[model samples]
Target: MATTASTTAPVSLASVTLEVADPEAAAVFHRAFGVDAYVGLRAAEDAPADGFRGFTLALTVSGPATVDGFVGAAVDAGATVLKPATKSMWGYGGVVRAPDGTIWKIATSAKKDTGPATREIDEFVLLLGVEDVKATKQFYVERGMAVAKSFGGKYAEFAPGTGSVKLALYKRRGLAKDLGVADDGTGAHRIVLGGTGASFTDPDGFVWEGEK
Candidate 1:
């Protein structure tokens, strides 16, 4: 593995293919946002495993109207609302989970003046709640991803590639608690990541596939 320095690697998420039980249904809900859904037996499985840990999809759009529109569309398509859209530290947005068991955060930066949304999902981030942020960040760094920003062992953020999704690391317990879920996330992550040196699962159990 070729580990990059703290801010040197060019690693970024290319796509997030979620393993879902019903690709058809999941697609119907996620289609608007460009989320690829496949039967993973997360697509083929009959039920969510005990302590099923879910990941959050950060949908960074243009502004409030776009945020409300997109997130509302998801809810209409069968997504459960985890948080209503509102102004937050990050921006104006909310959270929801599609029927396929994928959670999403629909948000926008308040400082942005980017008009309306250009795509259903402008920016995509796969936020993993890890047991140890330091170790996890190091694991990725060793695998060639450079750290864009980090707060010691608490949280770490990666910058986007030319056209890649962002990746971030946070403490598992704190993240789960923020999402109002159990820290012991079980079951498959049902996520597919591209644009890495190789394919492997992190210590926290989330799996990744390689693209570059």
Candidate 2:
């Protein structure tokens, strides 16, 4: 007789929910920022969270113009500009802290605009800043996630797998430095990830709940 092996379904990020004190206000800001479609808002306790929130939501666009456009819209929507849109060795991008305390990064790989900037997002990524990248990466892998890219202990990106938001892991301190913020934070992450299959908390305290 042949024995059968058990297999588990791969875990994918289905939705991202930002727990905000005022969902209505957060929705308005997200709408103005042009990312309302990518995130969900829910009412949460107005917990005291200082410094970086241990994560960032990044929007990848087409060109520099689009990057600037998104950043401008975010600022106009009452977000504080952490980093102005500028061309760097890797790309052109900027960082903004939403009115609800979520940090957002809008960036583009293309240095120049080939056409007019449109309200289009190429990719929505949730980068979790963890204390141990390798350990967390292994945790996700053991839970049936396939690694899309890995840079040793520094960074790790997982396959999106039909999910709306791509997931990645980065060192907490390094991620905060990249976003131009201090790495000292307390209280809840104030974000929830909707995942397919069983729910589990990651090593870094990021919560993932199975979608209903």
Candidate 3:
């Protein structure tokens, strides 16, 4: 019997898709969070992954993970696989549930490329809770966040696609619910002001600051 050659290459962490009641709102909040520019804010559907000019973070709309292929690959690498891949409502390729139950999906389509790609990470995100959605939205807008789009009244998105980092300001109650937490802003729900940037809290009780 002849042995077949292995052709399957490993998958990289292409995008981290977060499922929220309002994609637009989430987008706006993320822009304020200072990660919009980090991922290049280009719709994955609009162009090829390479079509993106500057990438801060990529967003892939998919279900959750509920299998071994995705998480297994991460584990194979040096990083510890928090959760096994599995099915989810958000529609991630494969969801990797973190130890804290924070669902994280792995990219199944993106492959490791050997090109002159600039991979310089200058920002990170810190999730927070807000009581008022409208006020929170305005706060970031006033701060110079460009509202890319709005999904009805359910959500709004903002981000400087070609700038420094991005930001995401979301409804406290809704965001907490998605994180499988209560609406009381209880437990570990403080937004992490990454790096050494300035931070502030919103009217809805959400805290944020720029990276230093």
Best by TM-score: 2
Measured against the true structure, the TM-scores of the candidates, in listed sequence, are 0.80, 0.94, 0.42
lDDT (Cα, tens digit) per residue for candidate 2, span 38-137 = 9999998766666778999999999998998999899999999999999999889999999999999999988888999988999999999999999889
Residue pairs of candidate 2 with colliding backbone atoms: none
Task: Report the Cα lDDT for residue 85, model 2.
Answer: 91
- In order, candidate lDDTs are 0.69, 0.89, 0.36
Q: Output the better candidate (1/2) by TM-score.
A: 2
lDDT of 1 by residue, 10-128 (tens): 45566667667777777676665555431122354553554546467677877888888878788888888878888868678788877877778778886455676544566777788
Model 1 stretches astray by more than 4 angstroms = 1-12, 33-42, 45-48, 52-54, 111-120
Give the lDDT ranking, best first.
Answer: 2, 1, 3
Error of 2 at 3 (Å): 29
Name the best candidate (by lDDT): 2
Query: What lDDT score goes with residue 119 in model 3?
Result: 26
lDDT of 3 at 64: 26
Give residue 50's error in model 1 in angstroms. 3.2
Model 2 C-alpha RMSD to native: 4.7
lDDT of 2 at 66: 90
lDDT per residue, candidate 3, 1-212, as tens digits?
A: 11211223211112233323334644564443323443322222321212101111222321222123334433443223433343344333333332212333343232332333222222333233344546656665555455665554345565533334344545555554444334442332212223222444445433333333
